[model samples]
Target chain A: MSKGRIIVIDDEDIVLISCQRALAPEGYDVRIVKSGMDGLKMLESEAFDLVLTDLKMPDIDGIEVLRIVKGKWPSVEVIIITGYQTVETAVKAMKLGAFDYIEKPFTPEQILSVVKNAIAHRASE
Target chain B: MKTKVKKTLYSLTGKLILTIGAMMIVGSITFWYFLIYYQERELLKNSVKYSLSFVDYVKKSTRYGMLTFQQLLIQQTVEAIGSAEGIMRVRIFDSKGKVAYSSKKEEIGTILGKNDPLCRSCHSESVKPRDMQSWSIRRDPEGYRILNIVQPIYNEPACYTSYCHVHPKEQRVLGLVESDVSLSLLDKAMKRQKIAITAFVFGFICLISVVLCTILWNLVSTPVSILTQGMERVAAGELDYTVRIDTRDEMGELARAFNAMTADLSKAKKELIEWGNTLEKKVEEKTEAIRKAHEQLIHSEKLASLGRMAAGVAHEINSPLTGIVTFGHLLLKKFPEGSQEREDIEVIIEQANRCSSIIKGLLGFARATSAEKSSANINDILNSSLNMVRHKADFFNIKIVLNLDESLPSIRADASQIQQVFLNMIINAADAMDGKGTLTLSTRKVVENGNPFAEIEFNDTGHGVSEENIPKLFEPFFTTKPVGKGTGLGLAVSHGIIQDHGGKIFVKSTLGEGTSFFVRLPFYEEKA
Candidate 1:
């Protein structure tokens, strides 16, 4: 079977690189963007099964992106990534229809497991 | 205003002297009146008796002459005695009521009336006398007093049967003799005596009054005045004043008693003043002690609040530490067992452990662990905490310089807490510099309030806090750092720790230049 398609959005380049490195090896197709604005442009052109986004961003935070994606494609599941300071924001994003939340500097396994669980949940739906 | 007691004329001594003088005057006056009256009466009696005796002698001498009818001899004898010193006149009246013989030649043949002054004594309408000897005292119109005496001669057998008067024996012949006495000399003598007695009495009353006045002054007025003056002084609040009366009477005893009472009052006043001074000093001392205790209580409350804040910040830091540790383990799992990558990951793991230990220390504080103290060198504690952050400072391009004094004494303190304070200050300094400056840590000996202290200074070449923000730097949750960069509890916690160890932390800074933090801890003095 083909792996899931994923889009990662973050202001920190390191976090975007780490998420890309951890999620790509499972045969999933993942694209990385440096901002929530760029991530939304990518979602407009291509359909994505899951989106991983940082809650705090320079232009358009993750929650706004989640709101737009849910309004257009209710089928796509979004996972929230947050720093220790923005944990409360990550929770708020979850209540607003995000799939799950993971703290930043997360282990590779932690991110992969949550991403897998979100894809399976989407397929079941 | 002082009030004066009114003086009275009826004082005790005045009344006494007045009464005595009045009685002496009355007594002396009565004695003088009676003495003059008795003398006058006695003189009058003696004069009257002598005149009567002379008249009788004349009568007897004339009896013989009358027997021979010698009227000239009778006249001579009467005239002789009548012209004597006190006698004014002499007369004889015959049976026919004629003045037969008279010492005054003008009255030799005057007929004597039954109502004449001399005869009226013997012959009045109340009693017609047959034979009577009478006398009278009268004042004539010329203002002279006179005494008149009358003696009646009765018929005798020898007279009737005399050879010259041979008539029937049935006829009776009678005559009278009278005398007058001048009293002007006696009146002059009595008047002179009255003047002498009056003068003597007046002089005596004057002398007695002077003597009585002197006695009153010596005995009553002088002593009473002294007592009155003393009382006035005492009433005017001159309690130290005394009266002096040298008399051996009740007044002298009263003066001595008043003096003793004044002395006692003075002594009691002195003792009360001394007691009041001592009480004031004790009250001042107690006030100072209570003020110090109150300050200590306020510091303890500050520490307790900081402790609670430190607990919350610890939890915040723990979350990030967890992230760092988990990712480091994951990275190690992806590397070979002995690879350089794993070795680098170990460094990350080791720093994360350091972070956890700091959080653990704060948790311990939240648990209200009693502070454990030991003799500790402040310089050593500073160096150890400094080593923990040395690598972090190196990565931030911050340099630390030390100027510790080797001779500084150790203090009784909790080493971990002291180290924590030093570490926080160093990190805060590095942060203020924005990762590029120098931090200087120094320790030396100093004194405050007669107590030896180990003084530590952390001077940072960093952009100091603004004047408005400096005062708030030590307050919990006060920060200039962005969110997630700090919880703003570092300096607050550090201040609590230092104060807990009986030390003080103070900051002085200049804007855009630097900040210097000074910590002073009292040195432990061993009991001798």
Candidate 2:
């Protein structure tokens, strides 16, 4: 089977580069977008199995990305990544059909586990 | 008494001094008036007597001169008059009104005419020459002429003859002698005497006035001026001012009294200053004592709150331990390990885990860990506190009304500490209502004393605290509950917690009506 395609969006270049490097060696075909609009454009042109996006970003945040992914491509799973965690934010992400949430400064293993779980769950669906 | 004392002192100095001064002034004035009046009267009387006596001497001298002239005329008037010392002219006139003989040859044949009133008197048909003894007139040349000694020539030697009988046809006639004397010398002497007496009286009065004025200035006015200056200094608040008067009379007494008054005033001022300083010190000591007592009350309240909290924590821990002990006993009785009955033991183990969690909560309460502060919504704290007390609220059948403000700004505080304060307040409100009446909770943002704060109010329809107990409501272990039902640390702990967060709590209660507690917390400012 072909490896799943994952898109990571972050406003910070360092975060985008680090996420891409962490997930690239994990056998997933990882793509990076610095801005929310670029991530959306990439989503419209290609197929992504999963999208991991920062909650707070310019133009479109992780929540909007999750909404669009669910609306246009229901098969793609989305997860939220943020440095600060709050109950209201978690509840909002869950309401928007985000697969799960992972806090920033998360270990490589934690990221991989959540992404795998989201992919397996999406396949099952 | 103070006014009386002041009046007495004032009278002793003021009245005595004034009276002495007034008496001295009045006595001096009377003495001067009488002395001037009597002395002037005596001087005037003496001047009048001297003038009158001097004029009498001049008149007596003129009368004597006239009497000697008449005697000379009577003795040898016509020719012997030339031997007189100062005589100028003499003449004799007959009863027929004719100049019989004259010192001036021109007047020898001249008839004294009836047109002359003096001749008419002597030459009248019924004239009595003895009644016309002496007469004087001014001559044409401004010389004084004296007419004297009109005598009757009688028919018999010593017969008191009537003029009509003696002067019958070819009868004897009386004759008159006239003499002229210059009066300029007498006039000059009278004028000189008058000038001398006038000069003497004026000089004496002037000398007396000068001497009296000098004595008054030296004896009275100088000492009085010194007294006035000393009094002015004393009036200007120089309490030690004294006057030096050397006189041994009334003015000296006045100076002594003035010195005494100044000494008394100085003593009084010193006493007043000492009293004022002592009063200030006493007030300061009283204020410090009150401050210390207030602090002690607050400290005692804190200690009482601590004791009650320790008891409550002990109670809370005991409950969980009882639960753990009971669960462990049931598990052991039900089954041994490694058997099918182990399944039931697992369930017992889960119940035991729940008891451990409750013990952890008790530990957290006991430890009183520092709160992590953040900007938190007030409603969330209220809701959590309500949730914690909801079971007790339902058990007591109390209805709670929330009038929370929706747009209240978040406060910077420890969320859990705020939750604990809210929980204690609500439980206190529910307990105050005795489990039945309504409890109202409200929140709003308000400004107090020019500072912005979040205000939370909890009101309960309960048997309220008495007026005497209202001040002690926040005191720890001060409860209105039955002996074992309440620890009384709830409100006290709430007070400390809110105060630690830079907030304040106030309670208002009416007996048998209700109680309301207002809590104010500061707002959080976010830095840009």
Candidate 3:
């Protein structure tokens, strides 16, 4: 069975592609969106167990998305992916009910473990 | 003569002496004149009385001869009396005013006319015979003063009743006896007395003037001269001078008062000099302090600008590094486990991670500070700092010697900030050694000016900075590293971090030898 359903939001194509490639091999469903607004739009139509969002983006920021997702879909978990500069704000997102925060330039193993932990958290809840 | 007298009059003492001398001279002149006049009057009266008494004696002695008509005996008596001492001559005039007898034989029969000076008073019609007994002063032929007395021989009842020579009562005056007394001796005595008294008075006045002048000079002029000399010295800026006056008078009191005033003035001058010196020192100290503060302000401004630039650059670089990292890992997973491509991908991932960490450091510099404070072990922070750069140090073939004090107390600090400072120092040391040297890290408790501090020293045995470059070592953008090897912000940011923690960072460098950087932080005591 699939580990969990996750939506990845990022402005960079390589981040989206890397997330898909890293998650697909582990037997999980992953969707990619380019911006926070697009990720929220996708979340309205689809039921996701976890949300992975970039803390910095052009259309909207990750903190607002984390707040909106946590408010609208109470069951979904958020994991904020932050670049080096936005790590402090990323931690703030965690306090705002994000499941966890991850610093940028993360390894494939690092991303997979965090996603897995987030899914397990949803299951436990 | 006029100028000499006027000169004497102008001078005080001379004027006084001259005035006294002048008074003495005038008084002597007046007294001499009165003395001569009075003595001459007395001498004239005494001479008149002697002449009258001698005339009476001649008349009495010649009375028996005259009653016997003995004219020769009477003449002999007159001659005898006139030859006495101080008697110039004697004459007897008959009733017709002819000289009946004379002491000088040439005047024995000389006739006296009514208009003659001797007979003018006694024989004049306006004169009564009883009022004619008078005297007069005359100068004789030899210029000798003489007193002449004229006495009318009066006939009384006995003369009229005499048997030899009887006269009627109506013809009571018989003849006149004239006696001329010499006055030269009296005049000579008065002249001698006048000369003696005048000489004595003048000498006395001169002596008194000399004595008075000497006394006045000692009492007033000497003291005044000393005081004037003292005043001149003081006016010439010699405040230390004092006047010496031995007299216990007003001048002495004045001298004492002046000495007191000069002493006070000297003291005030000394105090003013001291105050001026102190003011100059204070101004110099204040100027030095201001210069130090100005340098600090400029350093702070430079750091603030650099921090802002670092933040913007960090934000721009971090996103791209993330993308690069993510793609590199994805590519690594695509390759087989033993492939060279996987290894290349690992290298790319490693480089990207390095870039990210650098960006994280830049972010740290940007944020400048976090409000969070916690008690952290300095030894632990030091170890972490070494671990972060251990691989780089190994790659550079550099050796690091640690001399941490194990018993160092924990301090209140932000671990991450302290860690950044350490890391920067380590990296700089590696750079300074040019990838081949030893770095000695030492930690100890230090006391500076009675304040306890934790000292961390980083000694590097690398090509040391020159003396000229040592001062600029901590300045922003000042780097000795090659173009691509250093950003030049490492030491500046490190210095800022240490300063923010209320610590000091300093360096000691010697050319061609090595450099040591020291960081001193105040010890944090737990609050009760």
The TM-score leader among the candidates is 3
User: Best to worst by lDDT, what's the order?
Assistant: 3, 1, 2
Model 2 local distance difference test score: 0.67
Give the best candidate by DockQ: 3
What is the overall TM-score of model 2 with all chains considered together? 0.38
The TM-score, computed over Cα atoms with residue i paired to residue i, of candidate 1 is: 0.45
Off by over 4 Å in 1: A1-125, B1-13, B51-69, B94-98, B109-136, B140-145, B148-175, B237-242, B249-528
- How good is model 3 by TM-score? 0.61
For DockQ, candidate 1 versus 3, the one ahead is 3
Higher-TM-score candidate among 1 and 3? Answer: 3
Docking class of 1: incorrect
lDDT of 1 by residue, B220-276 (tens): 778877888988887787878888887788878888888898788878888999999
True contacts kept of each: 0.11, 0.00, 0.64
How displaced is residue B418 in candidate 2, in Å?
Answer: 7.7
lDDT of 2 by residue, A8-80 (tens): 9877665566566556767889999988899999999999999988777769877888888889998888888
Task: Select the stronger candidate by TM-score from 2 and 3.
Answer: 3
Indicate the DockQ of the complex predicted as candidate 1: 0.07
Candidate 3's docking class is acceptable
